[model samples]
Target: MNSDEIKTGEERPTRNKWNLILGILFLAYGSYRLYQKLQIPDDDNFGMILAVGFIFFGIYDLWKYYKGV
Candidate 1:
């Protein structure tokens, strides 16, 4: 394709709707899980680790959306 035919900027599609939705869901769930863990006396390392992972993944997905990736 010719350079003149190439698309750029606004011509490109924005982030997928589903991606944003999933990211938001993940963030909310992870935050809630973390809070619940903190409220209880039980100290489960695995739960905390998973919660942190989900939170980070959600953050990453949101960041990707902003970065237009």
Candidate 2:
């Protein structure tokens, strides 16, 4: 194969559809859970903390996709 036949890095890469879908799903679910958790009066509940973690993870995933990283 000739060198010219190889693809160059000049072309823009396509993002995965699944990544976008999962990111949105995670973000939405986490937000919803967080809202629910906040309504509870229990201070010992760790649900909110876990929910926030999910939200951050989702945000990071979305950011990676958006930045083409």
Candidate 3:
């Protein structure tokens, strides 16, 4: 309880490695989808939506990991 004391294992928030990796993968997949869509003008709106969703969730995961939220 000391002001200068540091929190140990159980008291500290731990980052989820799996979440981090998933986030990275999601981002990569989203980017790839977007790129493919750009290369094909006939791409459907669904593709864009999926890409955006993936990117958004990926960013959310990374944010949670880094911000400990």
**Where does model 2 exceed 4 Å of error?**
1-10
TM-score of 1: 0.77
Error of 3 at 60 (Å): 0.6
Q: Assess the local accuracy of residue 15 in candidate 3 as a C-alpha lDDT between 0 and 100.
A: 82
TM-score of 2: 0.75
Collision pairs in model 3: none
lDDT of 1 at 49: 88
lDDT of 3 by residue, 1-69 (tens): 796587555556678887788889898899888888889978499989999899888888888777666
C-alpha TM-scores of all predictions? 0.77, 0.75, 0.76
RMSD of 1: 2.9
Answer with 1 or 2, whichever has the higher TM-score. 1
Clashes of each: 0, 0, 0
Clashing pairs in 1: none
Q: 64, model 1: CA deviation in Å?
A: 1.2
